[model samples]
Target: MSLSAHGAEGAITNALTIDVEDYFQVSAFAPYIARSEWDQRECRVEHNVQRILELLRQHQTQATFFTLGWIAERYPALVRAIVADGHELASHGYGHERASDLSEQAFADDIGRAKKLLEDLSGKAVLGYRAPSFSIGTGNLWAFDCLAAAGYRYSSSIYPIKHDHYGMPDAPRFAHQVREGLIEVPVTTLRMLDRNLPASGGGYFRLLPYGVSRWMFKRVNAADRQAAVFYFHPWEIDTGQPRIEGLDRKSRFRHYVNIDRNYAKLQRLLGDFSWGRMDQIFLPDQQAGAAVV
Candidate 1:
């Protein structure tokens, strides 16, 4: 779809996304734990995702799962289960490598492999892709071209806020056509004091009071009059997962803070607003009548 193809419709329905990676696979933990040890670490993602599925079921909500191709290969049944439950199955690339870290060809191969693997597993056209950690930005705008070449219709790969790890502070906050056929729907942010504040999910959602997060999303809906894009990982809600030892205080705090309360907080979020898959909300042509939620 082109830029002119997208239109703002009434009845804003926010895009709810899940980055389906294990706790050990988080970008922050990459320094402490090597990718070779990923297979050795106790795999808790299956259980965690099942819990997430149940939670969404209770709330009668549907979401986009930007799942890792690595996980899908090991747990094909889980991929089938997500499709069986009627959720959109998207790609999180083959491995969780940041697009900024890869050569264009390597990035192309990664996304291509993941897209094919996911489509084969789910027997559905995988139309969306999200970078490992929102790693696509001005430096690697070519990643958008790669995504379009790989046949992905949309990408939620950029975060508009400034961050030490990954963000393009000057990027568009709302969905925009970054390539001929691909849309870059960045995660939500709130404009405050002349800067983009992180209003969507991730560590911020866990660190702040649930009320604050709710207020931010409401502000985006009522004030900005735009549907918000929120995201989180499965491991975030698992308080009992084994703690990684000998980590920097910053990484430790960012990963584990408020894990005990996040699940309940997420439950409240589901009830507070309307949510739907990325394709339904952004690629309206693929999901006609979805604009009204």
Candidate 2:
């Protein structure tokens, strides 16, 4: 749909984007071990994604499911299941490689492979992407142009925060346009002490009390703005999954923190906001809602 259709409307409906992958597959923890090790155990992730699909369907909500191409190719039926439920199928890359970790050409190739794989599976245009770990920060801004050239309408890779890894400290928290005419939907953040912190979703959604998360979204909407684009992964709700060994104390904390709170919090979010597809959440003068896993 054209932004012109909602040109003057205030506070666009919120978007709920689910990155349908296991938490173990996230790029943050990938450096601790060989991906081939995780590759050996795939069924856990598959089952977790299936569970998310059923949950969203039960809520009667349509969300954007940014799926990894590796997962899509292996679980073609899962991709079909998402589309069958009227959800958006966006690329979450072939594997969980960080865009910054890959050279521009390599990132392009990765995204290209994922786009082709996902489109072929869903039989629909996959016009959106969310980098693993929000890895497409300032250093890899070139990735945006690559996405636009690859026929992607939007990306949600620039997490506007000050983390030790993978955040653009100066990036906008709201959606905006980028070079090559591609729109960049940045991950959400809140102003804290003049610095924008990542209270957008994910671990924060799990870490913060439900009241905090609910109030933040309500605050953004009350300011006459669109509801913030929120995201999380299926593995987040599966607290029973086996934890990886060799991860640092901090990595373990960030990954495994607040696993059980995710499901109930998500249900609260669905009840509180009218979630829409990412493309529909695209605001005029800004871009689409790009989220992560």
**How high is the CA lDDT of each candidate model?**
0.90, 0.78
How well does each candidate superpose onto the true structure, as a TM-score? 0.95, 0.90
After TM-score superposition, the amount by which residue 100's alpha carbon in candidate 1 deviates from its true location, in angstroms, is: 0.5
lDDT of 1 by residue, 91-168 (tens): 999999999999999999999999889888888889999999899988899998899988988999999988999999
Candidate 1: the clashing residue pairs are none
lDDT of 2 by residue, 22-44 (tens): 66677667777677776677457
In candidate 2, list every pair of residues with a backbone clash: none
lDDT of candidate model 2 versus the reference: 0.78
Candidate 2 stretches greater than 4 Å from native: 1-11, 283-293
